[model samples]
Target: MLKWILFALCIVGIYFFFFKKPKTIHEKKEHKKDSIMLECATCGTYVSSDEAIIQDGKYYCSKECAQC
Candidate 1:
């Protein structure tokens, strides 16, 4: 009886340490989508494509920079 109980506890410990811990750690990681980068035509600053302003075939960091 004692041997069976010890074997069960060992199996549970192994399962928790090897399987459960890694699953939770992987699930908690934040995955960000890839973004394109473009250099500002005025100041030469790099900005993400989504936030950049496009004008006359050039990319700008902001509306003010685009006008300049």
Candidate 2:
């Protein structure tokens, strides 16, 4: 009986620790609204602003893509 109780407690603890329902992906992304997202001018692929190169108020994923 003690072993069964211990096992149940352990299961509940694990469930709370791992599956307590943190923010969903959309919620987390929406939380960072001020952060910039750069879209490829040519191909329209989305990339993070930090990874993009800025020139003339336009964001480029790479110099090669920018040239095309």
Candidate 3:
């Protein structure tokens, strides 16, 4: 029983190491590159600088938030 368990663990480890998808790692790196998180002046919600609306040196998550 112990030997079978060890074998199963080894098989699982090998599969995880060799076949695990790297899509998430790549996506995280891409999203984090040249971008930063900032707080909205109105609602105080945090948003990526790349997608946030910048007005008067304040970052906003949406146009409505910036309007405030």
Candidate 4:
């Protein structure tokens, strides 16, 4: 019984040490920056796109944003 209890405790400890926490503060901040909602230059609305237009070193949500 004691051996089984020790094995269980060791397993729990290993799990907590390895994969328990979600992310560190620095990682969380980096993730938040990556997930920032970009603003549409045309309508001034928030958008979430992987690729933002870069013209004259400015960010635009889409082609419509360039027109505006």
The best candidate in terms of lDDT: 1
Question: What ranges in model 4 sit over 4 Å off?
Answer: 1-33
For 1-68, candidate 3 gives per-residue lDDT tens digits of: 99999999999999999888675664544444677899988998999878899999878999999888
Q: Tell me the whole-model lDDT of each prediction, alpha carbons only.
A: 0.89, 0.80, 0.87, 0.73
- Give the Å error, residue 68, model 1: 0.7
**Model 1, range 1-68, lDDT digits (tens) per residue?**
99999999999999888776544555754546566899999999999988999999999999999998
Lowest summed lDDT across 10 adjacent residues in model 3 is found at 23-32
Give the C-alpha miss distance for residue 59 in model 4, angstroms.
2.0
Worst-scoring 10-residue span by lDDT in model 2: 25-34
Count steric clashes of candidate 3.
0
**Model 2: colliding residue pairs:** none
Q: What's the TM-score of every candidate structure? A: 0.50, 0.44, 0.50, 0.36
User: Model 4 misses residue 31 by how many Å?
Assistant: 11
Model 3 residue 62 CA deviation in Å = 0.4
Off-target runs (Cα >4 Å) in candidate 1 are: 1-33
Model 2 misplaced regions, further than 4 Å: 1-35
Residue 11 lDDT in candidate 2: 97
